[model samples]
Every structure is written in C-alpha cells, then in structure tokens.
Target: MNWFKPPVKSLLKLDLQHFGGSTLFELKQNMATLGQQLQKYEGELSQKAIDPSATLEDIKALQKSKEDIKARFDVIKEQHDVLEAEQKASFEDKSNIQNIADPKAKIVTAKAELIRATIRNQAVPKDVMAVLGDRNSTGGEKLLPTTMSEELLMEPLVKNPLRDISTYTNLRNLEIPKISFTLDDDDFIADTETAKELKVTGDVVKFTRNKFKVFAPVSETVLRGSNVNLVQSVDRALESGLAAKEKKVAFTKTPKTGEEHMSFYQTGETAIKTVNGADIYEAIVNALADLHEDYRENAKIVMNYADYTKVVKFLNNGNSTYFAAPPESVWGKTVKFVDAATDPIVGDFAYSHFNYDLDVLYERDKNVRTGIEDFVLTAYVDHQIKLKSAFRIAKVIPAV
Candidate 1:
C-alpha cells in the first residue's frame, strides 16, 4: 500500500545532461567538414581561372567538375541542416528535463512530516501539561510533551518543501493520440422533391466496392409505361428492381450493376451531378473528406471506385443505357456521413472534404453524352499520438 518513500537523492536519477551531447557535437563536426570541402573546391576553381595556358576544354572540364561537386555539397549541406535541427531539438528536451521540479515529491514529504508530527505529539502526557506553570507564557501544550524546545514544536520540521517532482514529471511527459487533417472530395447528394416530380433527365449515379453491392435508392424502381407517363418511369428510378428505358435516358444511365441512381446537382451534398468513372473520383473524395473530418483528424483511407461503366457495359452489352439495375458484382463501400459542427475549408472553397488526386474528375465532360457519376468512399486509421499538461499551485501556509 505504500506506493512511495522519498528517495534519499534528488528526483533526476538519470544522468541526461550528456544525453545528446556526443551526437550533437559529431553532427556539428560533420557540418564543419562539409563547409571546409566547399571552401576548398571554391579555392581550386579560383586558382584554375588564373591559368592562361588552360585550353577551353580544360576550363570547361574544371567548371563541370566544380558544378558536380557543388551539387553534391549542397545535398550534404541539406543533410547537415536537418541533423542540426534534430540536435537542437534534443538539446532543448534535455534542458527541460534538467530544469524540471517535481511537485509530487514535495506533497508526499509534507504529508509524511505531518503524520510524524502528529504521532510525536500524541505520545506526550496530558497530566504533565496540566501541572505546568505560567499558562500564558507556557507554549501551546503538546499532546504528549517531549524534552525538545517549544520553538521546535511550534515550527514543524519540513524536509525539501520543493522536492516533489513526480507530478511535474508526469505532467511534462503526458501524451495523447496524434492526429492529422486532410480533405476528401467525393460526397453523396439527394435530389429535391420537385426535380423528382418533373422527370428531369440526368446522369445515372454509380459506385463499386470490393465485395457485395449496394444500389442506393434500390427501392426506387423504374417501370415502363406510355410516354405520357414518363413521370411513372422517373418515379421507378427511386425504387430497386427492374426499370424499363426506351424513352431516352434522362440522367445518362450506364445501367451498370451495384447501386445506381440519378445524379443531381447539389452543392456540398454531392461533388458531381453525373455518375460515371469521371464523377466516381469526386464522389470518393467527398466521402473521404466527410469521414476524415468527422472521425479521424488525419487518417489514411485507401479507395478505388469500381469501374461501373466497364462492368455495366459488359453486363448490359452494346447499349450504354438500359433499364436494368446493377448486380452485386459492381459494388461500393459505405461510409457514414459525419457533419462537423462547423464546416471545413480548403483552398478558396469551404469544403467538408479534400481530394489528394486531381486526375479524378467529372465524367460528363469526358463522355460524348451526359456522363455517369460514381459515389464511393473507403477509409481506415493509420496512426496518431498527443502530448499535453496542466498545473495547480497552493500555499499551505495561510496569510495572517
């Protein structure tokens, strides 16, 4: 139960004053050597310039050699700079450790002294105190009087009041998970009720995954009826199962497997209006950004949007547009959207996500017809840590 007994010596037992001393000295020495090499090269180049007998080729060769040396020297210089920076950091850390004052040691010592004082006072005889003369002049009676002076009793003996360093040490070393931040571009968007009612033509949104398929709005079924009731066909797009297309593809439908829906233009909700290989990238970026900002500060998320067009075209045959919904083959991953209390910004635009790759773009512009958009997002955490501290100070002696 006794967790602590003050060490006879100071808290800093480790000899860290020389912690990075040798390494730093060596790094500085190496840097000085590199500098000297550069100076020597410069001197050699200058001396060669004074040789009138030197042919143009000889001069050119010397210049080339000097340039090569300078390039190599520059690399060494960069290395030196990096090493020096590390050395400086290490030095600062050692300095911090050396100057550390432990608060825990002081607190423990205070408690122990108080306990010892109480025990010593309790052992004194109460009868002896009652028999004492001069009640005014007699100092406050000890619970059990000892031969020691009243002055010594009045002032409790305290050893190294500032000795407690454990609390301070722990505070200085406190660490938490490290976090980084980035943006993903792909984002999902929903359509307005009015747009759905109008039967507006648009791109068929598509997405893929490693296994299994999720046809969003899979509930949104598409049925064939008279052209007069294209509204019915559009309504079917909201449901899952078969859909008949003959009345011209509204949202350029790739008719691929997995989740397929109409791509509508929504600002932050979705990055692309059309679902295709082109839009797949944007959707992915948006999805990543959402997940990144929401859960992990800086998480490494890997993703590749399923080539719905390739698979869809393969399944649907010659026609790019069809009424059929995607099968499980062409699938996409699902990432829950977590909105920030306040949205994040990147570049000039305030976006919830950021895309690492620029090549991923909208599919509509690339395709001869209105393009298909892709919606997909996948993510996982790589690593992280954090360092932090706090402090509190109290004066045990109250001011009179």
Candidate 2:
C-alpha cells in the first residue's frame, strides 16, 4: 500500500519568445514543465491502483501514460544538464574578461558579433579576439571551456596593486636616459666679489630591461576538458606571476638577480620610525610625517595583511571602533597589501618608475612531448625605485 504525493508546479510560466533561442533560462523552464507533467501522471497512476473499482484495463492505461511522460521528462532533464554546463562555462569566460583592466568595450563588441552571426545563420567564431576565444566548436554551436573559477584561479597568484595607483611609461628602447639629480648653488653677494664660482653637479641613471619568463606545462586533457580560453588564461597566469615577482623585487633591498633597485624600506635608519609605546594609528601618522610635505599628499601605505587586520581592530575609549567595519582605506590614502614579512612602508610611489615593452611573446612546443605540451611566455620590463628626495619616504618598523 504505497501512497504517492502530487507533483508541485512552478509558479513561473516563462514565455518562449521572451527568452532568446538556445538559452539556459528557456531550457530550464522547459525542463520544469516536463517534470510537473511527469509527476502529475505518476500521481494519477498511483491513485488508480488503489481504487476499489479499478480494473486491470484502468491500471494498465495509467501505467502507459506514466511511462510516456517519464521518457519525455528524462530527455528534457538531460538537455537541461547540458545547457547548465554550457552556461557555467560562459560565466567563467565572463569572469576572466572582467579581471582585465578595461574590457567593457571589447565585451560589447563580441556580444554584437555573436548576435549578428546568429541572425545571419553564419558561423560564429569559437574565439573572440577581445577576450579569450573558445576552442571547442560543434557544428555551428560553440562549447564553453571548463576552467577554474576566478577566485580559485587567482587565489595563489599575486598582482601588484601599485600598478593601479602609480603612473606608467612605455620604453621604446632598452635604456632610459635621464638626469638622476641636478644641483646649482651660486649666491650673489654685492657685485664687488665675483659670485662664488657657479657650482653645478648632476649624474645620470640608466634603467635597462630585464627579461622574465614563466614556463607552464598544460595537459591536453585538461585543455580539452576545461574548454578554457587557453591564450587568455595563460597570459593572465604569466602576467600575475611576473607582477608578483616584480612586487617582491620592488620591496627588497637586494633582488635575487639582475640590477638591484632601491626599495622604499631602504630609507636609511633616520627615515625609519620605530613603533615604540605608540598605537598603530599614531605610528602610521609619524611615518607619514617623516616624508616631505610635497610627497606626503600623494603617499600610499603598504603593509602585510596581518598588520592591516590589526590596524583595523584598533579601538577608541569605551571599545568603540574609529573605522567603519572593514575600512576601505586608512589615513585618507589607499592601502595596498602584500605578502611581506617586514614592517609597513609609507611613501610616494610616483617616484618609483617601471617600464615594460608592450609586446608579449609566446612559444609553443608540441614535438617535445614531455607527457604534455609546454608553453613559454616571456615579457621584458625594467623597474627602478628612485626616490627624487631621500626624505620623501618613510618606513614604520615595530619594536621587538
């Protein structure tokens, strides 16, 4: 004696025309409708079997109806699953595009192209130039590539936040020729005495290019299974890897290789203020004060995430917080976080210069079958942390 519950109908009745063709929404709605019908048929069949006057013919009819509806329901469910997978892939592609600095115009253009192709019954390109193009195409429909979500994909990688907050210049050549510093001190004292011989002194600092490369081996299976934008994904991965290395070099006194660039933290002992018996907020203020007034206006604070969390927890009397929950910034300036083990640094990054070639080169090797294909990405960049004035930056080191 088994009892079956009636199928619940969805209140949402979507119009087919309202949803564009071959869309996720339309497929999902179709699936839901099929499910409701299948459920209704099952419930009717169950009730008929329990009816006292029900004959063998009545039961058999109900069974046949139930089987027919179930078959249709299964087909729609399978379609729904496939559409869901494709929709998920599209979302991932969109996320990758969003991470790029300026992608709105490109996205708009790509969408327009897709629409035009659909309307004209023409072939839509699997890959879009503006964003990473899809690699899988079946018939006229393109399949979304499976790839890691943006959060998980970018979690292990690091990007230089300073790139967003600082000025950038492109170098046409390898070296940047510029005067490092100039000084002219000559005083006029009563035309009687020849003005002290004019004294002019200066030197030049040349920034040269450093070649950086990252080698990543991707399996053919993963590439095909994920259906990811291989070009864009690899580019992003390399860019992030390079930026992380750059950030490390920018903050270190001595880089592992190549020319050493002076870091903001190497401001000498005089420019370093120890947080002795002072609150974190006050310590940061003292650090900013150490910088000249001209540089102070555009100064930014950089620190480790751990220290930043502590700074945000600072409280006023009565345990009231001075900052809004999860403060966006501190000291009226942008705060950038790094994976640094050292103390916080406050300085004007405008004086720090970084130049790079606009072109990025890629080399692919399929013959060197090392179990999978290998991709080599390379970029040329030159960076120098030159402080126009020694007093324009300060480091806040906590007392042991």
Candidates in order, TM-scores: namely: 0.20, 0.50
Q: Which runs of model 2 end up more than 4 angstroms from their true locations?
A: 1-158, 174-205, 225-228, 266-279, 316-329, 357-359, 365-370, 388-400
RMSD of each: 33.5, 19.7
Question: What tens-digit string does per-residue lDDT give for candidate 1 at 112-223?
Answer: 2222323233332232222221132344432211221121112221221111111111111123212133235222222242133223322221121212111112111111
lDDT, model 1, position 47 = 73
Output the TM-score of candidate 1.
0.20
lDDT of 2 by residue, 160-254 (tens): 77676554555446344232333463232222111211111122345666776656555565354322233334435555666675676667755
What is the number of residue pairs that collide in model 1? Answer: 55
Candidate 1 deviation (Cα RMSD): 33.5
Candidate 2, residue 14: the lDDT equals 27
Give the count of colliding residue pairs in each prediction.
55, 4
Q: Rate the local accuracy (lDDT) of all candidates.
A: 0.27, 0.51
Scored by Cα lDDT, where does model 2 land? 0.51
Which candidate leads in TM-score? Answer: 2
